[model samples]
Target: MAVLTVPITLVQAAKQGDKVAFMSLLEPSLEPGYRLACGMLHDSQAAEDAVQEAAFKAWRKLGQLREGHALRPWFLGIVANECRTVRRSRWWSVLKWPKSEHPVETSPDSGLSGIELRRALRRLDLNKRMVLVLHWYLDLPLDEISAITGISVHAVEGRLQRGMSELRRLMETRDEN
Candidate 1:
């Protein structure tokens, strides 16, 4: 029998107290973590908090990580879990309330259509929204998304199809109005 060699052995060494190795291991994963957090929470502040918490948790549990090639998805799973935790907290309710006043924006890109599109996205159920962001925005395949979300591949496909239809309807309705 041949012994299998894996890159995560370096990560395991880092988990044993090699700071440089850990930093090297974690550097590439941060942006995706932030994006996932933002998609899950739909608020910049909440997303930042979730990413930070996820980083801390990932550090603490680094030793448990078994696969280096799969590290991105594993870290994203932690960030998504943190986002769920933040969303469930009481503070999230306060954050959820829409503010009465608006800040004037100079960016022409943020037109009425863009605003309506975002509002329509927010109208989606959380699972559908997650599927859309993960598949469409993040460009994850159905199987990988299913792994991260703990849904079956068929369920992921169904959610993506339903979400696309709903989003189309929403944009059309907004245009009509």
Candidate 2:
């Protein structure tokens, strides 16, 4: 999906506490933010909650946003942080159920590979996984990912390479078993 460009006037209005303008500026980012959360958390419900909480936090912290900065990456960064918070909660482990060993029968068009890919993604460490999600799943460029991750472009590139290598190893290992 194409990212929408927010008008500078709208951003100014939002900074000045215009709720409508804020919502307008925020609307386009919600889907991508949710997808980013889902990619990180691997649970749709948790992802939704993370995105919602991030949206609230973004509004509350809007004043901290610097001028000329892009909102999409900023919002996604908030979503990513929220996902991490949710994962770190004490209830996170308690809420997770072990997956069955045997794969369920899926229809021909069900894209079972996608399911397996997500399972493998869940096995990755958060840093590598976040880079993989932001780059591959969200189609974000390295610079934007660097901004969101608070890392250098070189670091982002390294993570992407390592993440892809690890992901490939995991996928190959899965195929062998």
The numbered model that scores best in TM-score is 2
Query: Cα lDDT for residue 34, model 2?
Result: 81
Candidate 2's residue-wise lDDT over 98-173, tens digit each?
A: 5535333335774978789889999999989999999987899888899889999999999999999999999999
Best by lDDT: 2
Each prediction's whole-model lDDT (CA): 0.75, 0.86
Query: Which regions in candidate 2 have their CA more than 4 angstroms from the true location?
Result: 1-5, 97-110
Candidate 1 per-residue lDDT over residues 1-177, each given as its tens digit: 111223766777777888877777777778777777666666666676778889889889887777634666677778877877876788777755443242322257768876776688888987888888888667777777876787899999999999999999999988887
> How much lDDT does candidate 1 score?
0.75
TM-score per candidate, chains pooled: 0.81, 0.88
User: Alpha-carbon error at 46 in model 2, in Å?
Assistant: 0.7
Question: Global lDDT for candidate 2?
Answer: 0.86
What's the CA RMSD for each of the models? 5.4, 4.3
